[model samples]
Target: MAANTDETTDAELVAEIARQVPDASADEAAAIAVAIGAHLTDRQRAAAAAAAAAGSEETWDGKEWSFSGRIDATQKRHVRVRQESPTDPWSAAGRTDRM
Candidate 1:
């Protein structure tokens, strides 16, 4: 079968399920993952459409960086981040807790 391009495959999903439920047998994990995926397929499609419609973007100006996007389908969110130095990790720029 062709590999999944945009989402995890059943095998990958089963593996993750098995990892989370160590006591479950491989067959059991596979069955559960398949069922969950089937049940959520329509909801997943709707979420993808909503996220695409909401859109997101990231911008950088020297050390300052900003991202504007929906944190989830239900709300729009923005996050400002900064890098102290060329090698520094990006960090929340200001009071992002309220953002």
Candidate 2:
């Protein structure tokens, strides 16, 4: 099951990321957690708008968005996001990569 992003704090996100990726340093985990938190927040808003405007029979094309940021002095993380776009069933809000 996915963690509920609504109630998750930055510290909690960092902890969860650490648990999921034991090899990442503390700073790396924290960076990735923050990025994930932002992604989830944006997706939640899009889902709400889609719910309001979407038809029951609507079908979305598969899409994935990568959220990238500097994790540390030596490395970075790229998060691949996939979900239904708001109001538009053919593309994501910012960027689109076919999944």
Model 2 has a clash total of 0
Query: What TM-score does candidate 1 reach?
Result: 0.34
Q: Which pairs of residues collide in candidate 1?
A: none
| Winning candidate number (TM-score) | 2
In order, the Cα lDDT scores of the candidates are 0.56, 0.56
lDDT by residue (tens digit), candidate 1, 1-99: 112335554787898999999999998887777668666776788899989876742334543432323222224554444332222223432334544
List ranges where model 1 is wrong by over 4 Å: 1-9, 44-99
Q: TM-score per candidate, in order?
A: 0.34, 0.40
Query: Clash totals for all models, in order?
Result: 0, 0
- List all candidate RMSDs to the true structure: 15.8, 22.5
Per-residue lDDT of candidate 2, residues 1-99 (tens digit)? 235545545787788899999999998897787677778778998998888886564443332222222212223444434444443532333342332
